[model samples]
Target: MDLHEPVTPFAVLDADKVATNVARLRGRLAGTGVPLRLHVKTAKSVEVALMAFDGTPGPIAVSTLAEAEAFAAAGFTDIVYAVGIAPDKLTRVADLRERGVDLVVLLDSVAQASAAAKAAVPALIEIDSDGHRAGLAPDDPAVLEIAGILPEVRGVLTHAGRSYYAYTPEEKHRVAADEVAHAVRVAERLRAAGYAAPVVSIGSTPSGHTPVELTGVTEARIGNFVFLDLVMAGLGVCAVEDLALSVVATVIGHQRDKGWILTDGGWMATSQDRSTAQQKIDQGYGLVTDLDGVPYPDLLMSAASQEHGVLSVRPGSAAELPDLPVGARVRILPNHACATAAQHDRYHVIGTGSRTVRAVWPRVRGW
Candidate 1:
């Protein structure tokens, strides 16, 4: 399909690549007896979630209550609201449950547990693992304290976001294994305290693809394996070809004097996330690709304005694009898939390895 025909700055999804990514991740977790509870926080579309779990039975994990409501209304019955719960959100969680949607939540404090007590939604205790994010440590007394406040609490969960920071295969492996250990240990701790902690969950796209032991873990809430970004590829968690998401941008003009290709896709479309800066390779805004998605490793979106993305050649590089005149359409591989997708409201899905538009999937944003 002609990318120029579609309105510029919209997200283009590769459905075939998405299918293969899900399959490849399932292949990695085969024989582990744990289900791939997909984190739909990245894809934010029921259409994409259906494709992500095409033939599998897995609950979708969301990062927001708005996402939970959207997916629930779309016939998704089981959703894991992955983010730590805000006390004020319990009413919304209960409303979803009234609609027969199993909206599981996460908690780390006695205050949240008390807020959830009457709401009665099942909750998972968040574990810090190595992420050092908003979670309690495996042995923190707060675990039992929170559990006691809400007897409906069912499990312990952790996301080793540190995997995104690892610089070596060994380090990534250690992070993944440590995450697994942390979740398992927390579950063991809770069970020993007579809490009946039946669920032990661990995930993070980078660590989920590593050589980690998932023994005794009940759920692997891995996301981003569906549509990997530069951060995942730069961390060696996934190959560049595995990326299923890109931005179809139109070359509005050229800055021949400065050797720059000006595009209509700017920070408004690609987002202002520069997570790759901390990685071994910092793809300025994103790497430029041809209309068909073939990557131009040497070309980068060097800078961006609200409505303009400046594409220029890489430093210390010899690759040249001296003939990409104005009005040319190119796809940009994003740095962070979730943040980039959030900038758009819909996705134009193309055939596997082909650029023709096959379908357009609407997405949800906000909250």
Candidate 2:
């Protein structure tokens, strides 16, 4: 049996396209006077992380300690864990730092800062730009308080998560501007308090991809650009053709009567991230395409269960599955690249049906 025809569903990433995405993102950030701290959560693989930092100096952002450890092991020293670090994980951060790894963690609360200050690990103040998750307000008094108390605090970080809701270029640019304003406010507050808040980090693929005015932001951390998904396409961050990663699954059953194509790869393979569908166009689960990554004219994987994906067909497409056999392989672009990437342990690299066993990027599970 051919290796590419293996039983298990595989996640494939195109090296060539990923390089192009990285180059495009770098070009967009040019003349913005800010360094790009590429996020590693989207591409869990160290190989992909290297590709992200290719030709550029280190300085990458990660979401998990495991990613920090993995990248640190691979000789990447500068890593800012974007997620809020719990009080208990301080030891791990210290350990990585003790080993010469510049592992900068995020602190949102005074208590977290107090705990972090005792650990001797460098840290950043997670300032809220769009309030997608945990972080202090840009002008919140706690920003200065935490900056003062946490002597290890190095800088401030902000994510304009609202860009995910953006539909037009203007909306994305506005979110980017908001992020820059917020980060600048917090950084200035920290500086006024005698803290050397050097790094004013801002992010969001949509906002970063647009013509963002990063006059004050010292760095930007973005991830999804490495593997633009359906969500990025829907938000106009990138075209569908720019999507570099996809889930390759075999068609198991045909719903000729109901017009559904069942696949082994389902919600378990893709994720339950419906953030993209909230836009004008509901992409359902994702855009379903053929083996060559071409979306079928009228077919989309609208719904999915734990182990099965249901395909929604157009009004008159009974002849669409004429050549689709029981075991034909298909590619599925995920709704959210970050969430879907966290669901897999390995990425199966494929090229023209010839498969090469690369490396299984073990994910960091749990909170």
Best by lDDT: 1
- Report the alpha-carbon TM-score of model 2 versus the true structure: 0.92
All-Cα superposition RMSD per candidate: 1.4, 2.4
TM-score of 1: 0.97
Per-residue lDDT over 1-367 for candidate 2, one digit per residue giving the tens place of the 0 to 100 score = 2335656566776666788898899888876767788888888777777777774437899888888888788788989999888999999999999999988989888898888889966789998888787788887888877877786668988888788888887787788888899889888887887888888888878888888677878888988898898888888888988887878788798888876788888888888888666876677778887776678876777788998987766445573643467787788888888888777877765443344534344554543
Tell me the tens digit of each residue's lDDT in model 1 across 56-77: 4358889988888888887888
Q: What's the C-alpha lDDT at position 227 in model 1?
A: 96
Candidate 2 error regions (>4 Å): 1-3, 55-57, 314-323, 351-367
Best by TM-score: 1
Can you give the TM-score per candidate against the true fold?
0.97, 0.92
lDDT of 1 at 173: 90
Worst 10 residues of 1 by lDDT: 49-58
For all candidates, the clash counts are 1, 0
Q: Which pairs of residues have clashing backbones in candidate 2?
A: none
